[model samples]
Target chain A: MEGLIDGVLPDAAELPGLVADLRTARSGISFVYDVIEKLAERYELSDAVMVLDHPELGRQAFRSARRPIGEASAMHLNVLECPEGVHGVPGGVDPVSASVAVELCRIALDLDLYRHDSRHDGLTGLYNRRFFDVMFRRCASQSARYGWSFSVVIFDIDSFKQLNDRFGHMLGDRVLQVVGAEMHHALRSSDVAGRVGGDEFAILLMRADRENVPAFMSRIRAAVEANMEMSVGFSFGIAEAPVESTDPAELYRLADARLMAAKGTKR
Target chain B: MSVPASSEEVRLAPLGDSGDEDESPPFDALELEIRRLPGVVAVGWHRGEAMRACLSVGGFGLSALRSRAVQLARGHLDEPLSVELSDVEGVFAASSVASVRIIDILVAGGEVEVRLGAGHLIGTGRAGTGPEGAALATIRALDDLGIGASIELRIASAVVLPSDLGLAVVVSVVDRHDGSEHRSIAYASSVEESAAKAVIEAYELIGEQSRDQAQSAIR
Candidate 1:
């Protein structure tokens, strides 16, 4: 009764199922659209606008109605921000169920955001160490079973400490971001990249031989050099699966050892 | 599979030292830290042996809090941990959360007895003298209100704040029944009052959680 007026709210009896459906939605976009679709069907809402500010996906709105925009009555434009407990719908409109749906959608979005954040690096938008390790093991097992070959590339920014000391962490982080963006852009969809350490990054190149990895790294290196404001440089090492070693740990070590050697040669 | 190792500069201590042989895992420390993260409300673990958790979250940094919780759990738990975080934005809002407050404190015969009240409900607890006793007494009083379970005191101390801030009491408590931990600090003229307030502050969320659970069950 607190949120109910003359507008349509989801029937009280159907809320549990609706909430369950929203909870199980695979992603935030699906969740928001599902709510809009449900509202349109249940309440026959002629016009509705649901805006979401997602952490990863940015700002998006899911709107559903039988007519064009700007025609919705003031009653239909009521916004529900659950965290602040503010309801903006005008009097004589029943938005109780819609408000609940919006709140549930927000919750689902938060869950999705956290789930994503948990697996990826905050600064670089690359896989975090935990998830990268997970993918590495999965790839290693599958490659061994199928007798396929893959490559692990381990690299770090050259003189990264000196760069951070001279430029401060802000610029240093920008360099990492640029490097990460380049890696993301240059890598094949099947490949996996992660920010493994402060300045260190690891890439699992699916179906790639050690010999072929240099070509991919070259592209990434060129992109980084072209995009970066400062003259940033990096060194890398690569190891192949089955040929070098199928063991995940051993492959990492092999790649890391080569990375250290490259750094030494650069010095 | 092993977690990818970070540089030594950013590496955390190993998780093997989470708890002692005779005690349970250090969920209290983990919970206290997780709660301090942005957008976290009440957090609790499942009742069984599994290292699963439920967190009530709101505001920004949901991902940071979720990721950090896993990282922190890895540091405190030996087993692989899974966290289930939900957005129960208004569930733990201050509007409904309630806890008993210290109405009176009496020390006699090297023991401390504290009286706490919320509305018409009055609860009393007694323990040996000192900050530890005061904290325990506060927990006992919460139990007497039918709002708390057996609590293990992880830390109870009085410390002087920096920059002439003044004296403060910090109390960390773990609920044995549910395996949730809470920590809070309070500044008071006397150590006894400070400890009591800190414990009371810590239990407010737990109290709200239990009340919500009971209400849900009733509904």
Candidate 2:
């Protein structure tokens, strides 16, 4: 991958724009299209395609060429993040074609890594609201594909603002970290947990449709309560997704509603 | 070898050309230039889609270059991989907890295909023209002082049926290619037995490919 970037950046100062383009891309497909279009301009190529091994979509390609995707010899573009097939660009101009191909790949990966960082809470190192939104959609897709049920659990540190006011933000932060850590440890590999708010955490459990979600939530709650200060408690809510609605927004709304109802019980 | 063995510079184009629709330097050119670099004894890229040029700066070079060599080879890839360069020598998917052990950077076609454990492959010419050559070349691709001829085995999944009536194992071989390829599709009554059967089947398939290569050569 370094061979694609070494020293070439000095002459190809415009390469930064390629990376910048990655930031602007809203989705993976757009990231790929942005690369292909830019490389076509730089390498004087006619067409290209992005073959990606998306976790949900599996091995798939987004082609720009009017003709067949072409053979291996026609492959020009390559990227680091592409796990499966070659990220190739066909009919490219010499030297520039290879360099741009490699740069685009690196840039795309950088964009992804950067994007991932942005979706995580710096303190707890858990997924943030941004990732939650994305993963929720993914869960929808997964559930539909496998007919497996998923659930969303949302909870808040009861009277968290009070904890911050009394214990100083440092201790409050420490408690939040502890809660996040416990949730992380308690989670199954198929689960996604995010610190969506300061003291509020959300989890999406894949394959929990048939299982006792409340029981699972209670386990996590117990783990957190065991580690948390006596004054700090939690309220919880869970909604089964891929059941009534494939949309995560709907699930979020339902979960929030249930969360409020659960808090009412505490009151 | 005319290209200097000591300094192998794989130059890429894409000079932010405003008007040039050119892609970049050809893999063949990069391969040729890479061959010129010092200590680089052999070069092979399968089918051009799978790889590019890799360089291990200062010391580690062969593994770095193998990714780039994959740009020319042609084959089916199964699952993505990240190498654990540490003592664990575990092969995990990029998304998992493990980070890929990448000592150097090379223009790889896809993921890093050369598992340094594959044995005695460093500085050898490309393999996969047939079967035995492919397996041997695979070993040579990651040849180090004491490491060679080792395959990185990863199990994608293992499931025990109700009451252990049957067991299933998906044995993932992370040797040179990434992604899923079923060398042997079989079922067994025991998890241990099933996994063993899968490995044996993969070995048999590789052996057959090698023999076919030999037979074709003799013809």
Candidate 3:
């Protein structure tokens, strides 16, 4: 694909530098930004946004080049081999830019899948323990920087071991997958939930404080219960990051302790 | 703004024919047939989920209309848009814009169906003057396996430096049938060169997958 503009699109003399600029972007979001910014300079369009489906995050979009007017007739962001939606700017992407965009969007999608795999559990496809660690630390750091607290809830399925022993491992696995799916469906996209250990899950509710943790947890627990339907139950303990403790480890420890206490109280 | 306008009557389904493979309707032919619809300019194939129509962008570009299209697609269709929009756009851009109607595609139970819009159209100002053809054709095409399928593609990281000397691109491609993935990271003196090298490497990996599939079929 050397001299992509020249070799592929002979007529598009104006697209080489723009494609190169798009190539300079290190990630999908930045790629969208680069496309917008460079396109504005090259094509005289103002503003641009690229929206695509992300595996774990669902839908994600980025803005950079800025916009023409709202009346600028809509054009397909057909720069790549993706089914991505576009916003901002008008007229249309030059053919060569469209080619480059197609490849870039395809790459962006691959990255989303890669990130999802690296972070998710194999069996249940939920965020894994390692992802939990990373996200927890990020939440704590954000709390420190933003002066707001996010809540961490660590919970375990009641009698998961008993279920495994009685129903065998396959049923146990199904239970885990079901619970994970339920949790994913019940939680917001920004809220990250992970399978931390056998039968244990952790959720980080962004911008949530201790005061609202109960309502979120209660609503989720009920929903999960109804979804699971075989008399399944989960017990969780919530703690505010940076509010209850500044350290992510410390916050997790506190949440774990409270989880144990909650389990005891139930018993 | 040519959102599929829903008509009073929807011929929902070649229903209750779950097990009748002999009842295989022309649904298998819908892939190519969909493109010939009154307004469908292009086609995108994807794994999982029903076909969702993103509203037409007309002659302009997608930057303005994408969000509203996504929002409407989600509300109108039960499944989210899994097919890549860029590809669809590319297909249309590569073709003639003679027809005006833009129709979204759907597949199920060995059948392909296109729904007319549910009243409102999405996008900024007025787009093409052509009418929607959701009513034109019901049959959409399927892949060779009589299923909708899309290959996995991804861009890892592609970066070009301000100095104009160092450039790098990392790409990954996975086979949708199998979970195997190929990753490549290349560094070069130019961004285009790096991207080309990365694509080559990923393509090499995908080639291996093709060979494997062929061998498995032979066995």
lDDT of all predictions: 0.61, 0.45, 0.47
Tens digits of lDDT, candidate 3, B32-93? 12222222333332223454332222232344234333432332233454323332332322
Candidate 2, residue B89: CA error in Å? Answer: 22
* Candidate maximizing lDDT: 1
Docking class of 2: incorrect
Residue A97's C-alpha lDDT in candidate 2?
42
Docking class of 1: incorrect
Flag the better candidate by DockQ, 2 or 3.
Answer: 3
- Local accuracy of candidate 1 as per-residue lDDT tens digits, B145-218: 44324577889988888998776899998878688888899988678889999988776656556646754644
lDDT of 2 at A144: 71
Give candidate 3 regions above 4 Å deviation.
A1-101, A122-126, A142-147, A168-174, A181-190, A206-215, A264-267, B1-219
TM-score of chain B of each: 0.48, 0.27, 0.26
Better of 1 and 3 by lDDT: 1
lDDT of 2 by residue, B1-219 (tens): 011111222122221232112211233223222322222322222223322222211122435434423321111112121211111111111111111111221122221222221111112222322223333333333343122223444443455567846656555454343333444434554333354445445543543343355445444
Highest DockQ: which candidate? 3
Please state how well chain A of candidate 1 matches the true chain A, as a TM-score: 0.76
lDDT tens per residue, model 1, A135-174: 8988899888997878899988888899877864445766
